[model samples]
Structure formats: C-alpha cells, structure tokens
Target: DRGAEMEWISQYPHEKEILLPPLVGFQAINTRVERKTLVVELRPSLNLKSPTIEEVIGKLKSSYLTLLDILKGSLQAEALVGPSEERTELHESKAKAAEELGLQRKAHEETNPRWFNNALNYQEASTAAFAIDAKMATKSILAEMKTSGAYTATFGGYQMHKLGLTGL
Candidate 1:
C-alpha cells in the first residue's frame, strides 16, 4: 500500500524532477516518501581539502534562492490555470511552504556561523590542553627516573651515553 502510494505521487506530472540548485561539497544520495512527506538525503562528497566557511554559506544562500524561485514559478503556473477550489487550496499550501522555508533560511544564516566558530574554538582549546598534559607526563617520567638513581652504565669501556638514542 505504501509503495503504491509513493509510486502514484512520483508519477504526478508536475511533481517530476524537482529542480535542485548546484550544491558545493554535497550531493543528493537518495529521496523517498515517508508518510506524506518527501525526504531527501544529502551526503558530503569526499575531497582532498574542505571548503571554507564562506563557501558553505554561499551554497546555502544559493540553494535557498533556488527553492524560492521554484515556489514562485509554481504559484505563477497555478494562476494561469484559473480559479478553482483545489487550486486555491494548493496556492495556500505553496505560500505557507515558502514562508516556512524563508524562516528556516533566516534562522540558519543567523546561527550557523556562530555555531561553527564555537566548535572551532573548542577544538583548538582541547588540542592545547592535550599537548600540555603530554608534556607534563613526559617530564614526570624523566623526574621519576632521576629520583630512582638510574645512571648511565659503562659497557666494554664505552659509556652508555656514547651510544646515544638509536632506532631499529
């Protein structure tokens, strides 16, 4: 039953090929209908280097613009078809969807940069803390060896210090 429903929705002429904007560092992996809603999954594409924050923000803005354009076009098409109860309902739904999308875009623009900066700051602080801890651990080990009276011993008339550090 669910499969049949999904197939029907997908077969709708106007619903075919939802035009998505070009996205940087991301690609659409899959799309399916869950209940009455369409769910699309986007995965980050592998790259030798990551994109800058500004690039990410720009992509987001472009995608938002594309969505608005699609919604506007749909509204215009509906207008050309003349007035009917079904058309009226569809128009209202489209308007509400557009409004909701606009709100989401605004929220993302306001918060995403701050969230990214906080995450970067936290990573830097954690790395510094770990480095300091490692240094202290190494120093403590050296101090313990000194306190235990471990001294360089001579072998075959050669001082242990003469060997220095070596790797096999």
Candidate 2:
C-alpha cells in the first residue's frame, strides 16, 4: 500500500498553485438554490476508496489555513504602503469576511443541520476557515469535487466528521 501510494504521488508535481475563488461580492453569500459545482476525475488504475471522514475534515481544515495564509500574505504585502491604514483595512476585511461566512453557515445549517453542525465541530472554527466553505467544498456530507489533483469522497457520518477537526 505504501509503495502504491508513493508511486502514485511521485507521478505528480511536488508543488501546485491554488487559486481561491473570490467571495462573490454580495449576491454570492446567499443562494436560493444550493447548487455547487463538483468536478470528479476517476483514476481507474488507482481505484481509490472514498476518503474517510478524517481525511475529508483534514483537507478542509488545511484549506482554511491556506485561505488565512493568503489573506495574511496579501495584507502583509499591502502593509508596506501604510501600517495604520493597513491595520484598519485588515480589520474591516476580516469583519466583512466573517459576516458573510456567518450568513452562509446559517443557510447551510437550515438544510443539513446534522452535517453542517457536525463537520464544523459545532463551532465556526471562528478562529479560522470562514467555516462553511471547507465542509461544503469537500462534500464532507454531500457530493462531488474532483480532479487528478483533487480528492473523491463519500457522504460522511455525523460522529466521524468531528474526529479530525476539533480543537484545532
């Protein structure tokens, strides 16, 4: 198994560039139809099993860290202009982002209270990932998003979804 996994990973590039989709101005936060685009790529040769709950939550959590990294990185780059203004802008930006994320969390909770509440470990990770995006993006309790570089997953359980995402 280790050999197979290594062989699989070795075939890919060591580094990748990820571009986060913009948090669509205002119209983006609320969707009348909770439709999402999930791209799935099957590797017949690999025949991988559905990602476990831990893997799903882990990947989702990493993505939050990635977003924060991007946010901090850009804010730092902008700070060179004026430290005070940058601080104000950073505070406002974070507040706006948090507000939109909270709205999104409420929407998802209405539809799938168990999954949304469970995967987010019952709290917004408020210290982290905007909250809703990770579980939704990962389809931790839903369906489909894949690429040769991305992962495929099955619907996860209420209990297991909490395993790898809490206290972090």
1-168: candidate 2 lDDT, tens digit per residue: 111234334545664433222221122233243357544432222224655555564564444444555544443343344455445543454445545554543444334333433555434543344333343323322221333435444444543345434412
Report how far off residue 82 is in candidate 2 (Å). Answer: 6.3
Task: Give model 1's TM-score versus the native structure.
Answer: 0.25
Model 2 clashing residue pairs (backbone): 39-146
C-alpha lDDT score of every prediction, in listed order:
0.46, 0.41
Instruction: Compute each candidate's TM-score over C-alphas.
Output: 0.25, 0.25
| Residue-pair clash count for candidate 2 | 1
**Most accurate candidate by lDDT:** 1
| Model 2 deviation from native, Cα RMSD in Å | 26.0
Candidate 2 achieves a global lDDT of 0.41
For 36-146, candidate 1 gives per-residue lDDT tens digits of 999998765545466665767555444444554554455445434555654544445545544554554455554444443455643553344333333333333444455
